[model samples]
Target chain A: MTINPYHDKRLQWVAYAIFFALLALVPILLDDAFLLNQLSTFGVYGILALSLSLCWGFGGILNLGQGIAFGLGAYGMAMTMQMQSQDIDTNPIPPFMLNNALESLPMIWEPFWNTGTGIFLAVAIPTLYCLIFGALMFQARVSGPFFAIMTLAMLSAFYTVFIDLQPYTNGVNGISPPMPLEVGSLVVDPYSTTSYWIVYAVLLLSTVVAKLLTQSKFGLIVRAQNNDPERVRFLGYNVAVYETLIYAISGCMAALAGMCFTFLTQYVSPSQFDVGFSISIVIWAAIGGRGSLLWAIMGAFIVQGAQSYLGDEFLNTWILILGFFFILVVRFLPGGLAGLVELILGKLPNMSKQQKSPGEKPVDKASLKEA
Target chain B: MAGVLEIQNLQKNFDAVKVINDFSMDVIELTLCCLVGPNGAGKTTTMDLITGRQKPTSGSVTFRGHVITGENEQMIARRGLGRKFQIPAVFRELTVRQNLEVAYSHEVNALKNIFSFSSRQCDARIDEVAEQVGLQERLAVIAGTLSHGETQWLEIGMVLMQDPALLLLDEPVAGMTEQEIEKTADILNTMKKTKTLIVVEHDMGFVREIADIVTVMHMGSLLAQGTIQEIETNQQVRDVYLGTEDH
Candidate 1:
């Protein structure tokens, strides 16, 4: 069987190269630290959208409270950064802990004292949380909107638990580390060009790797599971396992983005646990065209950047503008930005790798009966 | 030798309605058995019970000497039982070849096959299955864009890819034209040497062409069972199932 035209590998790789090359040019052209930092944070948002697009779009597992995982990742990094600011020979206490009148660093906060383990845990905790949560949901046969609501419920749980844990979580103030993360001699200054490029480079790599994955044989089954899960199950696949596996991966990616957010922003706040943040991540995927990873990332950049830039205005018209785009996207652009691109590409001559045979009509019954 | 399939006094109830009642049947290897019954005759439900889609209220389903009753669909299928639904259940967004590739796999482990590409052996097998189902040319075509008849054939093709010993096909030719139906019949007839298939159909003409053994059900109970000629002439079967051959 010939490779389908939609998954033309060479074309896809070339597109990725072009997209990232253009994005990488941004840091070179400008030296403004504040602007660069904001753009890097937006890159983190793109990564979050990319994660959701994979799980919900290709993998067909919708998560409504993905922000909880992001919040966890942020905290994972924040914990380490906080410990970095501490003098272990002296007090070794975070500002949040000081405010709460804690005499000693809690036992649970010990691991975060090391920067390396903290980075690893930043991705790991959320990944494990999702692996466990998704396994439970899929095994119990909870899916569709029920799965969505269940995840939202989990997000509510995280919000409540984190906000109530005055000692560990700082009770809603979250953690703002006094200094940047220091791994030996290197300090990961949030506003530096190096940090901006790191975020940019990671997003680029993530997009390409995730794109390759969605095009692989595993991706084939993921799409199959998305389209007809029962059919996939009867064909000898553990449909729940597939969904759970991908959900964990999505969790890992979001957590990575959250880790990067800590590196870019120098802080983790309760706002990461906000339901609207998670919903916004979903919205970015929806508007960007959840079907295509690149488009979804673009959607995140466009919507999040616009909201950021325009939200600063006194009028606060950004929400209305975002609502309009959301309506336009959902009402007509069902495939999101990717669908629009495909529609245009399908119209252009020589756009597709394979051309239809001349006068070869679809093999409908009428034609076969006529024959 | 053990039969390919054994359903011992299987019963399924949805709430208060007994969908399948005390139904028992044994299928030998390589038999193209047709289950013909009217609408809501429990033909589909029996398939469901055998494939682990529905949990039987009582009794057991054994396949190839293994007790598969109450096992999940994934596990049952892994035990070499493949199935097709009444409506074509192929992955719509994927190409015909991709759908076949998914079913043709022996790699059931998700992590093992994540980075794996289509092997030469896998591609050759997919091509062979595509040709068998008259979809060799349409392998690259998106399943969603395929015609109704083509989709049915695609589902059958998917089942064949698993290379299962027994296949449960529910109304395999429900929405096909005469020529398409004939083509489908040819495909099923060709698989009789290595595969055991239990097809549920309403069309007498299609059943007459493909069935080696016919089991007739009426209102969730077995009405009659015999060869085509014996079943066609059976007065009881005629009264409930063959009463109107035009179906």
Candidate 2:
């Protein structure tokens, strides 16, 4: 039971259940395996968008290099998956490593052979990186556009280093041609229903976790921090800690999404960590409605679906079309698709109702008018 | 009696200018002290120094037998000192009750606040504060949608939710109707019974109603300190501040 009438938790859950159920039905109803597999990729993209939404909308952090975390996750998974394919007992070093004149299998590549370790590193590496990086930025009291630019600059540096480590990383070519992921004895093929289910389950799980977090008492402080960080600090909150933690959480989600992407596509490349890919993730969140997680998910699906459909037809003008679309959304609908929902909900009976604002004055309307 | 709060030889300078110099004041437990000054008398700056918003160039602020110097606002606030701004500083998007809940959840460290909190105690505290500030009916109303007076009361309620031992208020009744000011005076008067209060107010009439002690500042230093009647008659206070005012 909720104390406030404004957010009826039961009603929200009902709506949430219905949406996820419909999403679950997509693979069952669609006969085309190819389209269903593509849908799974879109779901993974949606997770990336949701991560950005939480950071930008809820935490008021603008990370221009969100792909850094996503790329880390992708590379972690790719490295692990690549190791899974080789007969490591006899031929531990991959062909690329040998080609680069490596004397021995590097100690860093050893643990990634285990899927659990790979996934663990995939999530943990980005989270720890962000936690340390966030603490530095926030403790120094850097925020807004400056924070955004710093993150972007960091991604450029990270990308340069990642490219330079050619022997371990495979450089520009990236990690590819992995065997199907094995869990115990069960082989999870890229196109398999098990893989789709894995992505589906995680997307839903993370969304709920995100929802619970943003609705918690901690969330209350975070929102308060966003409104007036100084006031919240004076109210006795360590806002730097709050901001840093949220940033770290967002990074974890992005990396998780990246890991899922690698599982579905069986490939992870430097392109995933590029500036363009990071910007695309932001555009999806903004287009979908950064304020609402569900809308952000839909934003990814719609944009990726449109891109696939239009990329073949309008290969030259696709970027310009997307730019115009972004401009229109920003100009006409500042809140994106989620704002439209709020506007509509406002008109519906009992939907947007809260206590009459300006408050219940003891003075009557006549007295107020006279005053 | 040992002062509940003490400020001694406090100084704050901006480049070449001394905003507050040798500012000294002691607030006894459970007493209301109003700081009155002319526009450039450094009233606001003194509040900043006490609250640790700005570290003093040289001085000490002792609260509850502890010298809190060069500490940040969050740490100082956690030491049981609450502050209210001249403008209503309540979170605009949150409901009145949520704002109170946030203020009541005073642990401030995110890790402790993450998964769980004392909601049962917090909710009770919220209701109590909402009632105290006469916002019981508007608990669910968004703070941004409040009228100017209501917003001020909400901020007061938020500060009260934490139940700090000392409260620092800056212009608690700025831009209010006559009745709102009276209500605010009543709230401050009530608070002084259980908590020490440091109020910076330009409204002389309001100060006269609730101030247990009046400290007048002139040119970044204390000109006079005494009861309202004493401050009114003091030749120095009249010359520096009272004489120039609408009083």
Q: TM-score for all predictions?
A: 0.94, 0.94
Show the colliding residue pairs in model 2.
none
lDDT of 1 by residue, A95-204 (tens): 77888888888988898878888888888999999999998999888889999999999998888889888888898777888787777787778888888877887787
- Among these predicted structures, which one has the highest DockQ? 1
Candidate 1: Cα lDDT at B137: 93
lDDT of 2 by residue, B1-247 (tens): 6798989999999998998988898999988999999998999989899898888999899999999988899888998999999888989988887788888845666877778634787887887888788999998777999999999999998889877999999998999999999998888888888988999999899999999999999889988999999999998888878788877
List model 1's recovered fraction of native interface contacts, to 2 decimals: 0.85
lDDT of 1 by residue, B180-246 (tens): 9999999999988788889999898898999999999999999999899999999988887677765
Which residue runs does candidate 2 get wrong by more than 4 Å?
A1-6, A348-371
For residues A303-324, write the lDDT of model 2, one tens digit per residue. 9999999877999799889989
RMSD of every prediction: 5.7, 5.8
